[model samples]
Target: MPKFLIVGATKFEIQPLLTYFKIPVHSPEGLFSTESGPDISALITGVGMVNTAFALGRYSHNLFDYIINAGVCGAINKDLKIGEIVNVTNDTLSEMGAEDDSEFIKYPDLNLPGTNYYENQVQIISSALNGLRKVSGITVNTVHGNEQSIAKVRRLYEADVETMEGAAFFRGCSRLSENYFQLRAVSNYVEKRDKSKWQMPLAIENLNSFLISLIEELEK
Candidate 1:
């Protein structure tokens, strides 16, 4: 059985997972072992790109067969349903670029400066992931909430979803493990800030449900 690590941005986002596995570490600090399934572990790396990078880097020395990043994301493509889960095939820091007047010079186009575009790395798409919609994503420090910024992003990248730590996780995963996956569930559409319009509860519920099923499958 392959060892796995479920990486999440926040505890609340993966609270159900902790409950399901019956992990004793209530205030999960670091790598905690469990008899839940095929040597599975979890890391609650605060939030955003910086926190994720630091947390993953701190534990990079520990080898894992697979690293799966799970969380809720904003739907950039209106066709995606509110509670639907997706597999991010590619991701990049969309904001990491220099603005030359109206043109934005993306990181990949820049001279030899270690890329933030992290899809070139081969991902292990298991049977559980083949059914999921494989979509491109862009990670950001600040989620798009304003109309102008949202519109700008929509025009700039051909991404289907947006997450806070997907790219950062992918970048670290490039070195940490060969088999990695970034799973994101849509909680809301990228529109003007409207908490009333978001379905966070449903997204979290579905995300956790899938995680449970995934772990169960791993047990086999």
Candidate 2:
């Protein structure tokens, strides 16, 4: 069986899923016991862009066959409410490139030397999430947006949601292997970090259920 590498942004995002898999809580860095999980390996790769990239690059150094970046994100579109899963179709850094005199130097699909550029893996991931309701494919990056920025990203990328780690995960996975996918769930709206409005708990529950089903399917 091909090994699947499950990457979560934090333990909060992965706790429920870990329970479903019967994976014992070993350490903060996610060193799982073979007696706990059968086939899957989970890693809690901190949060945000830089940490996520570093974790991916470090662990994916010919260590794993398949990589799945799963976590909670914020909804950019009002229609996509809380506790919804969003598979990443494509991603771009919201703070990449350069700032010149007046214009931001946006690099378009340029695969520099050995750096892996963006690619679409949504269809494959969505296929796995076929019957799972309230799931979407999103375009995510590091920076959360204001109204104007959200509007611009939605217009340009047609993304249903946004996040901080998807782009970096994509870049890292692309550099490592081709059999990787990104799965995200919405915990709050894009406006602000309102804990009262966040559905993190519910999202984790749904994410856990989703992961269990996916694992069963993979086993079959």
RMSD of each: 1.9, 3.5
Instruction: Give the alpha-carbon lDDT of every model.
Output: 0.85, 0.67
TM per model? 0.92, 0.80
After the best TM-score superposition of candidate 2, give how far the Cα of residue 65 lies from its true spot, in angstroms. 4.2
Candidate 1 C-alpha error for residue 213, in Å: 1.2
In TM-score terms, candidate 2 sits at 0.80
Off by over 4 Å in 1: 35-38, 120-125
Error of 1 at 49 (Å): 0.5
lDDT string for model 1 (1-220, tens) is: 7787899988778778877877655664456657654577888888899999999999998898878899999999999999999989899899997888988888777775687678934544457767788889999999999998988998888999999999999888889888888888899999999999999999999999998887666556
Give the candidate number with the greatest lDDT. Answer: 1
Whole-model lDDT, model 1:
0.85
